[model samples]
Target: METVLIEHFKKARRLFRILLVLALLCTVCIGIAYISIFLYAKIAGPPTLTVPQTAIFYSSNGKVLDELHNGQKRYWVPLESVSDNIKEATLAVEDKRFYDHNGFDIKRIGGAIVADIKAMSKVQGASTITQQYARNLFLEHDKTWTRKFQEALYTIRLEFNYDKDKIFEGYLNTIYYGHGAYGVEAASKTYFNKKAKDLTLSEASMLAGIPKGPTYYSPLLHEENAKERQRIILNLLVDQGKISQKEADKAFVTPLFYAKKAQDEANAKKQDASYFMSAALSQLTNELGITEAMIHSNGLRIYTTLDIDVQKKAEEAMNTVMNKDSDIQTAFVAMDPKTGAVKALIGGRDYKKSPFNRATQAVRQPGSTMKPFLYYAALADGFTESTAMQSEETTFTLDDGVSTYKPSNYNSYYANNPITLAQAIALSDNIYAVKTHLFIGEHRLVETAKSLGVSTPLKQVPSLALGTSPVRVIDMVNAYGIFANGGKEISPTFIKRIETAGGDMVYEAPQEKKQIVDKRLAFLTTHLMTGMFQKELNGYTTVTGKPILKYLSRDYAGKSGTTPTDSWMIGYTPQLVSGVWVGYDQGKQIERVEEKAYAKKMWALFMEDALEGKKKQAFKAPKGLVSVNINPETGDIATKSCSKKYKAYYLTGTQPTTYCRDKGVSEEKNQAPQKQKEQDGFFHRLRDWF
Candidate 1:
């Protein structure tokens, strides 16, 4: 019995010794692992922060229009520039115990752990503002034990390295707000179109509540959720003694102010001035080898050629006219003829619904709108306005004999009429135009259009006379601008200049001029086309109550055109050239002239508003041009008996050699004849016939 007892005791002693050795080994391994992790965390650098370039659009006068971004990227402003209310709200909501706690809040963390265990879910987070800043700036957003350990260590380093204000500023500037906004500066500007320094107490509280979960409490996406979060933040502010109970109560009742509607947001986004200035900035940035980071974080101050008032008016006109219960989409382009600077441009009604900028991207047949260019080309080709063309019905088969096309006038009744060159263009007789185009080879016409800055591909066909070829709105507007600029083709420019954030002028737009046609021909064509306003105005005023003709005090030229699908009205003064296009995006047929509302209404509104203060300027005729009276229908020397007389003007190079001889007729003869004379004339004609 004694021997068995001794054996049992020895076995128990051995087991106890083994258990003690295992415990010591486990402790040593854990200690080494922890030390290894600590060393790794110390050596590992922060993630490389990649900020995206915030796209800004500015009006011509340098007002911000819009800001665009693909992610939470924006211009970061300093803490001093941020409003005091926003700063206080941020401190109150993000870290109520921030000033009192060390790098780690032991009590809060302990309570959070207990609560998490009891709830069987992680609900509360005990990270201080300093810790959160350190984690966001220097650590990845992982919620593992290892990541938390690293965060705690970095928090200690951050609190030691940075003061409270510095830490708070960093937090305010680095935290992400919803809607692709980062930092208080960007959020304030995005929501209110103001800087961070301009935020009110309510606005500040609303902004501070967003960082808890940006998308979850986004004012744009979840307004009620955002309001709830704001209430919680206001209550916290009151509890933390940052604000009085009454203040909290008032703030809680305050309705959270959100950003404008989508349309207004789009307009607000335009204020950035970058979209119009991007081309120029790209050239400058490339020349300077500017990195992407500098472009985004530097908060660049760009000055552009955009006139803010003009752009606003243009946008308003386009929106008002295009949205009038019609399916038609409209585009408007305005440019300075002398400088070729595009002042205001609205590509489409809404870019979100349709990103295809009809002004820049679409290519369609210009219909009779192409007649001005054709006339200009003919004048350049030694054809005078008095030159007559055979307007008989005609058809032409392609040289390959695979296809045949016939051109007809808009009225479809002047097939056999002998129309003069001036009459052909003014009346937009397709047969006469086709015959004239045939007289001048297709290649020469193409060269003429190309010289005038029509960069689109032109099909060599008889239908080209009626604008069957696809042409972009920019090209068409610039082509018309040639006449306005006295035949000098100036490249259209959207940007005026580009500068760095340090106020360094990186690039300035250069003026480029090239004479595309004869100056005399340009002036002569402009003079002849000025009559179109009188003709088209009669049609427009009969439909709409507004008389656009009375608004044009000077001799301005304009033309209206419609294909089966698209309608266009391109007109110009001496200083400005505006082109408006209206049609369905899918190319539906325009029922009639009355139904063509988009282009005409948009054009009238834009012109009336754009030229408000500017003086009415007339188109100047070049040095050697003369206006003579000729027969209206025959386009020949006027006769005394001919009651209708039209002014026939000619350029120096293409003037009429035979001046119209006018028989001397008394003023009474020119006036209305007596009714008795008309009855006597009818009786005399009947007796002579018998």
Candidate 2:
């Protein structure tokens, strides 16, 4: 028995020796592994921490107009800027031992391993904050053993390189929050409609709860789930001794003011000056030679000429008047004629629905709005405002194709005889415009449009006189502004300056001006344009017969345009030039008969609001424009004895030399018998040649 006991003791001793050897080897292996990770991290250096900063847009009023973020909507804030409540809540919920652990928690990892083993899938995560930061910053989201091994390796590296504060800041700034928002600042703005620094204890706890499962705990979506998660966080805070049970209960019953998800989403979508910022950024992108990613991430400050009041008014005008569900889109652009500073731009009914800036980007037929360009071309040629053209429809064979084009009046009612050229413009007479366009040489008209800043293509077809050529609203506004400015053309400009976050001025838009036309001719054209809204052009009923002037008492020149699908009302005061376009995005013709009145009324309301405080402005008549009395029927100089007479404006040499025949009251009496019938306002049922 003693011999057997001694042998057993020797066997046990030998087995204990073998087990000691294995334990030492495992300890040595772990030490070497840790040392290797540390050395590798030291050699690899800190991970690239290029967190994107928010880009701010300032309005002319010095108020923050908007902010632009990266694709993830991330805007990094330093650790010091974070709310203490948020930090404690996040620590209590995400990683209580974040400062204690080197990179990971072994007990949590063991539990996760057991859980994953039973579930046969990654149903739980054991990553500490540092480990999560490691996976998010440098590693992938794969759940395989290899990815886990790599994640562990990176976690060790991060712990070796960065402090706890840095790791925490990066994690808080990069973690995904619900509603497509990333980072605490963005999340706070998105979910609470406030800055992250302003987050209350309850709000911070709620936000801190979102990072674990953003979609599942979104306060905007899963309110009950979010409350439950928040409760869990507050309880964890209490258990972690960061707060007492009394404080936790106080936070638990706190009335939370969560951001109205739908309204918040709508506001975010309709962010202030979205279209303006987009257009301004496009201009900057070309000049700076950078992509939009750089624009959003490079921490640039854009100072723009957007007027918040005007912009809001522009939006209000369209929103108050137009049908929301009809899918009809509208555009409003207002610019100072003197400086060409674009004050307001509403690109579409909703910037979220479409970012296509119709104000400056879309090309549509200007309809009768292009007539001023034609008339300006005529004045530059030999024709005066008093020059007469036959108002009846005339057919012209196309030189380019086997087709004949016949242009008719929009109202389909003409004077049946020759009317003065000024009358043609006031009436928007298509036949008279076509005749004058052909007479003035279509090429000359194109040159005139180009000189005035209509940069789109204008095919020299016979229908060009009736605005068949597509042009932008900006182009039309700029062109009309030429007359408003007494022939000096100012380029439409939006951005005033751009600076870097470091206060380096990158871009500053200079005032672009060019003398594009004769001052007298531009003045005469302005005079001719005002006739569209006058009760009569020198005692004869005009085609428009005061359609717009009846709505507003301002002494301004303006015109209305319509295709089957598009409706336009553009006008200018001496102080500002404004244009509004109403149409469908898909080019669907307006369905309502009240469409024109709605469009015009919107224009009038906006103009009234815009010109409210300022004294009414008047266009200056440049030198060398002649005012003369003429025989209404003869289109010639009127003798004092001629009873029927009309006032006309003309260039110095373009005034008529002829006089009324029979030279007396006998002939004037017969011509003056009928008071010109008050012409009905033009409905603009255009002759759709397409």
Candidate 3:
């Protein structure tokens, strides 16, 4: 019995020593951990809080236009902006001991380990709010020891540098709440169509439940599952002493209204300004050398040149005038002539049905709109507004001598007499245009178009003068802007500036100008285009713009073009330049007369409406141009006695040397043709030929 007592004493002594060693080892381990954390805190610096955020786009008027993001949309709001209910509900559901623990809850983690061991799987999480935020900001959601270890280190680092409120705010902002929503604010807006600060207890509880298993608890997808999870969260809130039992019961039974319905879900995929936003994003990525992935992830603030009011006017005009049932499509673009800013643009009638940006993408024949470039070339080639050409039917022998080309006027009607450049333009006289195109050489028109910013490829064919080559509507608008802006070349600009999420400047557009067209020639060509609306310029045909003249309240210089498959009207005032194209996408003939009329009528309506409440300014003539009264029939300086005369613009040395011999000419000769042309209404019959 003594020997047994000795052996028991020895065993007890060994057990005590083992306990003492363990205590010392644990103390050393704790010291080492503390030292490592201190070193890491010294090295890691401040918390970056880097997370993907939604990029916002603002209009010129400082209104939010749209937003872009990755699959998950996040809008960061300060802790002050989040409702107390949301904070309470999130704490109850996600981490109850959030403020009590530094970065990890020892008791909760021990409980979670026991629970997982009982389940024989890693089926429980004990992450505190700070740990989750660290994982969200720095680590991926991989179920591995390495990820967990990294998450722990990051959590310690975060706790060391940031206060509890900052870490909480970051967690609230970065946590994924499902359905393409990455934060409390985005979730609130997505589910309730309200700001996060406006969420009630019921809505906050509903949103809070989604973060655990986003897809499983999403109110939008699984309503019953979401309700059950929300009820659980409300009970947790009540048990945590954050809310009363009556409040929990009331929240659980409250009738909830979701922001999105089945149809709304479909419609949300396509919103207003989809086309314009797409174009701006394209420019941002392609032209500005910014990658789309960066744009999606980085919180960028893009300020665009879009005038929201003008954009609305453009849409209203298109819808108001267009036949909604018709399949014929149209594209429109409006710009500030001086600055080259694209204030308004529409790629197609409906962006959802089709995303083809016809304004910048479609290359359709410009028809007679090409004449301005051609006429501009003529003016540079020493051809005045009074330059005369025979408009009778003619076949041109090609340089090869074996080939001949025949071009006819609209409706095969011709002046059958010599008509001045101004009259030819007003009539859209194809015969005279082709004759002049050949006389000056087709290469001249090609050169002129390029100088005016036409980037599309062109063949030096006689029809080039008549705009047979296909060109983009946007390019045409910019080209017309040169004429409207007194010959200064301007690029079509969308984004005015870009800024980082932190308000650092990324890019600011430079207001640059290049003189491509001579100011004198641009003014002279613009002057000739205005003859389209003047009744005095009528000769073999009524002016092409005569049909839309009654719709105009301000002076505008423009041209109209027609092809078998396309109808175009591009015009501008000094302040704005806009273009419209109407046609079938398949290049089918525009058979309907009303469809043919759509371009001009739409242009008239949009310009009038868009420029409303703004100053009505006239086109300013340059210093060297002189205005002269000329006889439309004679292309000669007009006398007071001349029966019909109109003001024409000429360069100082380019005016006609002869005066009109109208004193002895018969009244029938002078007045009869003008009356006949108006009565015929060449543009009224444009339906048959346009």
Candidate 4:
């Protein structure tokens, strides 16, 4: 028996020794495995620290017009930019021992393990702010064991690479808050109508509790639930000793404005600036050849030609004239004539409900606004301001061979006599316009429009002179800009320069000048169009412009177009050019007189404020143009004997040389065919040609 007992004891001792050896080997293997993970974590780097940053837009005068994002409005401000109130409140509720632990809280994890087990799922996450940030930055947020293990590895990497402040800031920024707000700054603004740094303790505590379940705690959709969440957060803040019980009580009753009011305020503040952002981003993507991901990730700083004051004035102008009851909507765009810098753009009356950009996209008939192009084509074809056109009833068989159309004046008040080309344009006489259009040919007008930047296709018909072609508002503005800038064709550009977030210059618009129209012809046309100023009434009133001169008293030339549905008023000074359209976004007629006049009134109101405080400038005539007083009755060089005359600008040598005599007749010096041919003048040749 004693021998058997000794043998059993020895066998048990041997088994114990073997078990101890296996345990030591297992410990070494586990240690190596841990070292391998640590090495990999150190090598993998800080899990792509780049978060989506808000793209900033700057106006021409270096003002921040907006901060926008494609998907989420996240403004990644500095760590110091975050208020201590929010920091303490978030730490109190989300991770009470965030700074006390290295990356993970063992005690929280243990408690979460029991709670999750009891709930039969991952109903509780003991994730420290670091672990939460790791999951957000690098790992997929799955509650499975594999994702949690991977999150642990990334958490170690995060703690090793970044300090507490960076981890907390990164966590705050990367964590999602509802209502499309991605970061604390955005969430603060989303909830409280203020910046993150300006958030009060109560606001901070309420926001800090939101990330737990944004939908569940949303004060916008669930006010009572959000109030309960806010109460819990206040209690947490008091328990953490960040605030007193008295403070908690005060914060419990804090009046909280939900995300809706904040959004409304932001929309009211942004106004039409978001539309500009949308347009600018489209251009930036095309210009830089970068993707939307690149725009958000690379942190591009878009410098645009938008003028803040002008944009505001435009918004104010639209608001003043437009109301909810008003059926018509308006599109307005203002640009710099010299550089083609688009200073202001209001695509529609409101951008939120309807984002369709009317200024750049919508195409509508231009009515008499397109008459300038026809007259420009005529001038290019050697027709001068003195060229006379008959406003009598005229009929032309359609080139289609199946239809005949008769064109008349706007009010059907035809002069029944000859009117010079200058008077033809100023008075907007469609009869004389069509007569001159057929005389010069429609193809010439199309060529003129294309040269001066009318991109829309124009049909070759007599009605083409009367703006039969549908045109974008930008098209009219750019085309008229040619006449404003001494006949140089310029493409309207919105972006002034572009840069990376680090201020590396990517693009700057080149000053390109392509002379598409002759300087003399442009000056001649401008002079004739400005004839609205030449008329003097009983009182001291300016006589130039399409009733636009009544408000825009300075020297500017433009045209008014009226289709059955669209009304366009596009004009330009030497400094600025603007186009205003009043109509519905959908194809609908503006039948009311006041709605139609809104286009012109919007133009005058915007220009009246735009040109304010700036020097009142005049357009200087290009060389080779002469200002001469000519007879409106006979298109001849006016003498004192001529009772009715106005100062007219004419192409050099195109000025009428004959003198007006008695009975409103012209006195020719000779009667021979060659002398009669010489005395016939430009107007008579054009008249006889048709």
Cα error, candidate 1, residue 11 (Å) = 23
331-425 in candidate 4: lDDT tens per residue?
A: 88899987888899988876777898888888888899888888877877777676776667878777788898798776567777777776777
TM-score of every prediction relative to native: 0.69, 0.74, 0.87, 0.82
In model 1, the worst 10-residue window by lDDT is 537-546
Question: Whose TM-score is greatest here?
Answer: 3
Off by over 4 Å in 3: 1-34, 37-47, 113-125, 200-206, 215-258, 261-271, 320-322, 400-402, 512-514, 663-690
On the 0 to 100 scale, the lDDT of residue 33 in model 2 is 84
Per-model CA lDDT versus the true structure: 0.69, 0.78, 0.87, 0.79
Q: Give lDDT for model 1.
A: 0.69
Per-residue lDDT for 470-498 in model 2, tens only?
A: 89988888788878988886877777888
Clashing pairs in 3: none
- Residue by residue across 1-690, what tens digits does model 1's lDDT show? 999999999999999999999999999999998686556555653323333336454556556644435455576566798998888888777776777776667887898899899999998877788788778777789779998877777776666555677777777777888776778887887677678998887888888988899889888888889888888878887887788989978877777556657547665655322323444345336654545565555555545566777767877877776556776777778889888888877766666666567777789889878777777776666566666655666677766787887776555556364456655666566776775676566766677778878889998877777788888887888888888889887866765665643457765677877776788888877765665654421210121212356554555677677898998888788878889888888999988555575676677778877887888887767778867666544554465665456777765323333323442222222212354354345335433522
Writing each residue's lDDT as its tens digit, candidate 3 over 543-599 gives 999999999998899999999999999999999999999999999999888999999
Candidate 4 lowest-lDDT run of ten: 536-545
Error of 3 at 177 (Å): 2.2
